[model samples]
Target: MSLFRKPQPITVIALRDAPDLVTSLRRALETATDAERPGLERALALTEDVAERPDAELRGRWVRRHLDAAGYEGPADSVNAIRVLRQAEPGLTLLQALTYARETAAAENTPL
Candidate 1:
């Protein structure tokens, strides 16, 4: 048997479905221990915030917020990096894309 499991495909759900997503996260949070609380709470908050804003560019805003939280201060650079990452790897989760983008940005001595 293989030691590692296959990477699951990440689903791209519509922003309109945020309520269901929030509910599911809340349920998970209810049973999550202290260690898992922060990440779950952050996800819940981000989901609700995104749902409240009727932005046509929802995914861009999400990527921007994630980059901001990670201390990537260049707004335009952040947007461009995420755009390239999405185009290059459409299947990447936000975390995966941002992580890779950040590493690349750092290695290139550029902002992201």
Candidate 2:
């Protein structure tokens, strides 16, 4: 233990998928970097809200907005940002974040 330091509070969000169904994704989230796990959850909440729309442009725009909010943006078509967002938000699974953000995506966030 560090005598001169304290641990920061991490926001961990559990998933609602069958444990076996999302075993891999669950482990990924569990072992993800402290910065990543919650960020991914945030992205999922954003994706779930508007993923079924027929508006491709709107989705893209929303993705951009979320990226900005999550501080995940970089150069145009940032591969890193896309990779994180996809993995964080049910990219290859049917899981859902349990602790959904209280406010909708349009609301301001306190920097996760």
Candidate 3:
């Protein structure tokens, strides 16, 4: 019934439970606005304080960080958050999944 084959999804293995701060910030800085550049630059300067950590070792901190980043203020529902993240997009690393979950939670006004 079709002339072309369906595309196959690419598989990715996540090596870390958290994002790399320097790499992520540098990537963002490449396209940052003038107003946003200062804050991102400050964060880059304080990477030691605001760096991503293993979620398993610091679940609360992980949840709080994501929630705060998403501008969500509510109870921390980390389990559901991680679950939703995983279910959201296959092959995404936890770092990206967690960010997606945070934005989703904030948009839906739901605690995650």
Pairs in steric clash, model 1 = none
Q: Which pairs clash inside model 2?
A: none
Model 1: per-residue Cα lDDT over 1-112, one tens digit each = 4547675554433358888899999999999999999999999999989668543245445555555665556642475666655665578755556655554454446344
Question: What is candidate 3's lDDT per residue for 1-112, written digit by digit as tens?
Answer: 4547564342333245124777788888999999999999887777745445333324344445655665556544455556543554345555555554454445446354
Q: Tell me the lDDT of candidate 2.
A: 0.45
Between candidates 1 and 3, the one scoring higher on TM-score is 1
Candidate 2 weakest lDDT stretch, 10 residues: 93-102
Model 1 scores what on Cα lDDT?
0.64
Candidate lDDT (C-alpha), each: 0.64, 0.45, 0.55
What are the TM-scores, per candidate, against the unseen true structure?
0.37, 0.29, 0.28
Q: For candidate 2, lDDT tens digit of each residue in 49-96?
A: 544433433444545565667777564244565554445664322111
The number of the candidate with the highest lDDT is: 1
